[model samples]
Target: MSTSTAPDAKTVRQVRPALRAGRFSTVLRVPALVTIAVMVALLLVLFALDIAIGDFRIPIGRVLDVLGGGGTRAQRFVILDSRLPRALTAVVVGAALGLAGAITQSILHNPLASPDLLGITAGASVGAVAVIVGAGGGAATGTLALVGVPLAALAAGLATALAIYLMAWGKNTAGGSGVMAFRLVLVGIGVNAALMAVVSWLITRASLPDASMAQHWLTGSLNKADWSTLIPAAVGLGVTLLVAAASARTLAALRFGADTTRMLGVKIQTQQGILLATAVMASALATAAVGPLAFVGLAAPQIARRLLRTPGEPVIASALVGAIAVLGADLVSRTMFPIDLPVGVVTAAVGGPFLIYLLVRTNRKATL
Candidate 1:
């Protein structure tokens, strides 16, 4: 056997790439754990801030006391009845939207792929609007109508998603390959436009009071949040979160390439369907609970990925980021502004510019 010696310059050069990759890999190893911890802590702090900064402006200490069930009756009402449920709704809705966005973007390998853009939210709006307009809007107040609103949204959103999928199916439906990303997005845009027009027509047909209520729901607000809203949001978010977490590995693998995923023995089409359905469910549930908040699903996942700098989808991070984004937007709408704007409006204001920037960058790159 030949004795080994210190490597020469040529050998060292050849081995440098492996060494570099190994070093780079370690940066994400420990820091990834730290990043997740930081995110959780930050989310808790933000949640507290949201509770503390409302009209009465409870101190953080008092907020904690109220949460712990030691505050006065008025404080209790404000915290438990008013603020707590709304805060919880914001957190869950944000998380669901973020998770949905991450899954959609990852599956389609498109930054712009989100439930809102795909017209899933519009479909929810259509369902909710139909119920409201059909029921005579403000006159439709009953326990049944409350229950029906969310059910209608879920059904309509799912149907809308099914239609988009079928329309975008193309020849890829036969195999394990997923729908083409661009084609899916394009079809989604068209469907969204058509659905929006239907929503407009429904609003126009309703009485003034009903139209106003329908408009409020369409704008998306947490002002109406109560136990009723919280229940469905919680159940939906919990179920979808589990499904997404369990299938995260398969979803992440698909990010590499279809050929790589197939070679690794993943059923690409089935996996895609599972992930897409989970995303749709998450989006529909959030919309059902608090109306459709624009851009949370679009912006949250991208923000989380940028923060984590991970090759895989930052599923947990996305959820946290989403919760933070909605809560932050709501806080601003409540406090910083003269009037309480719909949380969806704030999100749209932020997301609209970001979307434009993304489009511009994408176009420039394609042109180059």
Candidate 2:
């Protein structure tokens, strides 16, 4: 064997990336772990920012005191009523989107699928729009914005999922996952357009006040969020998360293939129903709270997957990534504009181009 001189520092540095990457592969992929950990840190920072940076600055000291123990009534009120509600809403909504994105993509086995493109968000919008325009007027706009149309959104999400499944199932009667996916996407496109039409009709019928309320809701803001909206959304999300964690194995299995699922003796039909139902409920509740933020659900999970490069949907990872994305967007929205922009508007602006990029990417991958 030929003896070589000692490797220089530059050569060692050059080899470090591949070596570290290899070592990382032996572990559970550090990027996913880092992303999640960073998200948690960012979440904490965002909460502090929310507390300290609003119009009435409480000072970080008082904010902590308000969170922990004794503070004056005014400080308590600011923390409890203002910053707390907004922070909580952001966290809850983020978690819901993350979970919703994971389940949607897992069940459908399509990285590109999301409520935005899949029309679940649209369906929720239709429901919320109906309530905003058709039901209670100005007096109840706040409550109606979050609650009145929530059921309608839930119903629409479920109905749309059922339609896709039934239509896709019928088409795949003889065989083929490829055809099922294609036709289901095609159907989603049609449903999305149709739902937009319904929303338009409702907007026209809305009184000026109602229409303005609906407009605000449609753009998807968390500015007016309060405790009244938080409880129901919390309940919806809490219940759904337990169900998702319990069903992860089956959900993961589904990503491989339906036939693999069948072979593994997983009740593909029943499990799928559970996954889709949980997705619908969580998504509807989040949408109702946040006003049909169509794109986050679509964009978040894909970003998580690309970042992590995990074998399957990486459900927990996706959820954390989503929480970060939404909260980060909200933080920027609040600070970036002279007036605090709505979270939904910010998400749509960021997520829209990401959607187009995904479509192009999918096309390229399909061709490859």
Candidate 3:
């Protein structure tokens, strides 16, 4: 009886992994795919609406015709040259922000831990403004001008992240690690405030045209979208998404506390660096493309987790959600107003209320 039981226990251990694997595939993986599909379908619809409903209101058929190089020159101009880039910008930037938000929230293990909160976006903003103000009001001329804005933004964002990490690292009096997360958030807030002040001063010092350009960029307009912005954004989105997917397992392990993850033989700091770098690049490039669009990064990941009912950060789902939110907001901003509004304004109006609700609910739960 003892021998038989021993064999049975060994078999159970073997079977358990198989069961969990099957469960993961069925439960989490399949649902995520389905969510992505649904999001893609919704995006297609929104993209069509956005491209088709301008002053002329081109039909979907004609839009497709222009896309296929079969439409008249005027139709082609409306669909291809003008609307296509802006719509693509919304999708690319949104997806990037969504992915960035998901990674940051997961690693920090805080709902409020996002790029905007962590000063990354503010850093990008500062970089952009400096370029704008320095270049006699941000005109896109001279050598290396085309790539300067985004590169500066990216470098500044990375620098901000590094600064936060360094500032947050402190040894306790007992010579042990103190509370890193709390320190990170606190430092980030301070940095963000300083950066914003710098941006304001720079704008004030710029020439009228340059100041106007700076202000428009700060508002986060898709109206300024062109092939130049769109192409780089698309490439960045693809690269970041791939890197995020590659780092997903490490990201998931981070939820188990650092010691346990370390015991599992993962190089914790290396993985964290990869994830942090990816998040910063994603957010920074997106900001460079569309200015610092707020709340999308803070809101998209949480929304995706809720939508997917996942314990882990749903990076793909979050990306889809971000894209949908941006695309939808862009449509509303352009159409549902007396004049076109900035996409950031629309997101802020919606996200501000959502954030308030989150705070209230969190407080209520804590009190209860």
- lDDT scores of the candidates, listed in order: 0.85, 0.77, 0.84
lDDT of 3 by residue, 1-368 (tens): 35543456545543212225543542235666677788889989998888998778999988888888798989888888899988989999999999999998888777777898889999999997788767863475444345878888889999999988888888755465644676788899899999999899988888889898889989898987887877656776888889987766778888777778778777866787788888898899899888988899989998989877888668988888899999999999988999999999999999888778777877888799
Write the residue-wise lDDT of candidate 2 on 1-368 in tens digits.
99889988776744223324643433344566687787678778877887677778778877888889779998888898887888888778877887888887887778777766777778878877777677754434555545666777777777877776677665355464323666766788788899889898898887898888888888878887788767667877898789988887788788877677789989877887788778878888888787877577777778777777776667776777677777777888888899988888888888889888988988999999
Better of 2 and 3 by lDDT: 3
Instruction: In model 2, state the lDDT of residue 363.
Output: 91
Using lDDT as the measure, the top candidate is 1
For model 3, the local distance difference test gives 0.84
Span of ten consecutive residues with least summed lDDT in model 1 = 14-23
* Cα distance off (Å), candidate 2, residue 310: 0.3
Question: What is the Cα-based lDDT of residue 261 in candidate 3?
Answer: 79
TM of each candidate vs. truth: 0.90, 0.87, 0.89
Write the candidate numbers in order of decreasing lDDT: 1, 3, 2
Question: Across residues 1-368, which tens digit of lDDT does each residue of candidate 1 receive?
Answer: 99989878776544222224643432235566788789888888888988888778899899999888799999899888988999999999999999899999999888898999999989988998888878753644556455787788889999998899888876554364457778999999999999999999998989998898889988889988888887877887898889987886788788977778889889887888888887888888789888889889988888888787876558888899899899989888998889988998999899999899878877898899
